[model samples]
Target: MKRQHVIGMFDSGVGGLTVMKEILEQIPELRIIYLGDTARVPYGNRSKEELIDFGEEIITFLISQGAEAVVVACNTSSANALPDLKKSFDIPLIGTIEPGARLAVSKTSGGKIGLIATEATVRSKAYSSAISRVLSKGVLPEDQGLRESWQQGEQSIALVKSQACPLFVPLVEAGLSKTPEARGIARTYLSGFDTAGVDALILGCTHYPFLAPVIRDILGEQTALIDPAQAMVDELKSVLDKLDEVQEMKAKSTVKETWKLRFYVSGDPELFQSVGNTLLPGLIQEVRQVIWGD
Candidate 1:
């Protein structure tokens, strides 16, 4: 918890760069070490046990790189592996599901929230569970009215509809997110949202943000698209603010602005750089490769 602490974040592929982008914009003073398991991209179909093993290995690599805190930028890993990772790692481990769910609930006027994510995430029902918890707790200011109604002996219920777009990650990674083909797939995957009539739609996968324009056009202006990375970054800032060491350092004068952004991939660095630079132009300067014991 220094003035310029290192934060490690990992995802199955370049998708996590979406989350890292928000962090860079909001907390640029801190160094970031991002690892993308591009060799095993699209964790949508992976088993929970495999995900937990992958999470442990990736997190260990991040810790070796001097990371003081870690962020699970992949929804699949967050849904499946976060609990075990927390038990294994002592640092502050943050995930994307709860923050995104809270934001979706807060913005939802009709009490109907929609979620679009990878197959693994949808299978786990993490978003639905998180949304239910948020509604029950009534922690958000927007839920105050519901809380009051509940206190008056009225039942407050929020409905969640989730759809799994298994191909989204592959499409985005292949640099086809802006293409017509991607739109067609998005239309098919998101058709249910039109019927569900959710006021807010959570872009549950980190990769889905790249398809936001296509999704927005399909869903129209009525539905608000929630990017969990934004909420996750806000939560990260709050966590950083509460650290006594960070506060003490801030109180002292003239903390050097030491921040570095580095990217690592378990797969082909060139492919990762190509897709990453396209998704987030000018943000990716260099990408290095990391190998795991097979």
Candidate 2:
């Protein structure tokens, strides 16, 4: 495999592992190098400048390791630092927002989509802007799912109801996603989308999938829950196809000769291993500790 086929992914912490799982499952033949800035733990409260600096560091580190394509797996980083990173990096750098937005726009039938993410993601309006950009493409029929129209050089977007589920991340990290308290918290946070009658809901935070069952039960069975990871993986696949990087698909075990996964974290490897085992068994057995500079 060429160096261009290897993807380097980074996040504030283990949350990005969700995206990694999707990438591994969907594009099993692709090589991946993952880094988690665990010492920083949460980037949700950081400023945009800090996010950009941190993202630049990770991107540089990844490139030095021979990663040709960089993926920002953290929603917070994707929302805040992606634009600058794209401009600064020579490689084709991708984030999670646009793909998720496009998917949600196409999936919403009632012309109303709800978003649940961290406070930083909500404040950044990355999803809101991406959804608007997609809706701005053109007007479509009811079957096409949007009631939007393009007129006077502007495109009207469907209703977007976004909420900051800041508490969701910490709970997931603490392994309380299936608890009664978690359900109560999810119920309190998600009732607005249920009331808005949103046909599709975006899991804007990478960490939000752990709470999927609670979210689905509260939002009812009809609402389409959109996870950006799969969409991001699809976007990556498209990039590889366009770049002539993808060879052929094969069974995961069969592709082991060419496929590889390496993990690094800025904090305790044991903690990463312990928590990651619950997410993906045997995937976290060996993680190298990556210091800030190294």
Query: lDDT per residue, candidate 1, 175-204, as tens digits?
Result: 999999999999999888878777789998
Score every model by TM-score.
0.91, 0.88
TM-score of 1: 0.91
lDDT digits (tens) for residues 1-294 of candidate 2 = 332367899988778888998988878777788998888877888899999999998889999886868889988899998998889988888898988887787666766778888888989988888887766664242433244333333444454688888788778766677899999999999877867778889898888887888988888889989899987987888777755633444322322344388888888888877777776678876789988864
Clashes of 2: 0
Instruction: Kindly report which residue stretches of model 1 are placed more than 4 angstroms away from their true locations once superposed.
Output: 1-3, 141-157, 244-259
Candidate lDDT (C-alpha), each:
0.86, 0.80
lDDT of 1: 0.86
Report the lDDT of model 2 for residue 209: 82
Which RMSD values do the candidates have, in order? 2.8, 4.6
TM-score of 2: 0.88
Model 1 is weakest, by summed lDDT over 10 consecutive residues, at 250-259
Where model 2 places Cα greater than 4 Å from the true spot, the runs are: 1-4, 138-142, 145-159, 245-259
Cα lDDT, model 1, residue 152: 71
